[model samples]
Target: MHEVFTSAMLAASVAAAPAQLSSIDELAGTWTLVAADLIKTDGSVVRDYGNAPKGLLVIDSGGRYSLQIFKAERVHFASADKGAGTDAEFRSAVLGSSTHCGQMRLDGGQLHFHIEGASFPNWEGTVQKRNFEFTGEQLRYLVPARSDGTVPVSVWRRLAGQAARP
Candidate 1:
């Protein structure tokens, strides 16, 4: 009787343990930037995505993320090895283009990102975090200001059937 009771108790405990956090595998795929809203310090709204500026975000199953931003009449520089110019000149001439590689993980319902790259030199040692809320077809991510500044919000729509394979 004692042996049976112990076995049952252990089984119940195992079953009661909370499920592991969902991996980035669930979010892996190419995601197009649909729209963005920026809240200014004075509480004004800015709809700047529909202009010349555009953005793209790609998340891989291996917890890597890449982001690209493009704008009209922007002269961006490439690495000298790519035949653009010297490394120093390339870095100085790069105006608004940015490429960042980062690790991402999902905890509960929040998505966390750790950024790394020379593209955004200021963000080299920083970890940018965001909270994600999902609806039927849209996922809204809210990013709070690191300091006491205004916050930025992004809304992404999933491409049909592009979720990572199980």
Candidate 2:
């Protein structure tokens, strides 16, 4: 019963999405993160990654991909050695960045991630779906709503001269 309902919901979402790229090859290339925001139920926006978030996304023609996002102002560890960081520094580091990678599938306007690994261990070995749209060189996607009802949205811009795979 649960599976049936889930399938129905998935079908509905796909049907409701706007026109999508004709082929996944259209999404192949490198993208730079432009904005990361959390929209509250009351319609206020919060910058989850500060004013200047840094991120890179690379997707290959074979459907393999890697992604990393960082807070521009994340505090550097006081110690030179990465293995030697204070608890505070470690916590700050972990909380300020997001990284994950794996195979991807684009179905309609949905971007599905078969997460093989992530900075947040809970996401490893999980499959997540996001709704996305493209505008010129930019792509925007909405993350599933969090338990607190805030939705995270990410925007990315394709780099110059990155050709799409046929």
lDDT of each: 0.57, 0.77
| Candidate 1 worst ten-residue window by lDDT | 1-10
Best by TM-score: 2
Off by over 4 Å in 1: 1-21, 48-52, 73-95, 146-148, 161-166
Where does candidate 2 have its weakest 10-residue lDDT segment? Answer: 1-10
Give all candidate RMSDs, comma-separated: 15.1, 8.2
lDDT of 2 by residue, 77-137 (tens): 9989999999988987998899999998887467888999899999999989988766547
lDDT string, candidate 1, 1-166, tens digits: 0011122332333234343336667667766655454556665545433344556777887878877654334544455465757666555446545456788777655677788764768877577766665443444565665275655556566677775455
Candidate 1 residue 74 Cα shift, in angstroms, is 3.5
TM-score attained by model 1: 0.62
Residue 150 alpha-carbon offset, candidate 2, angstroms? 1.0
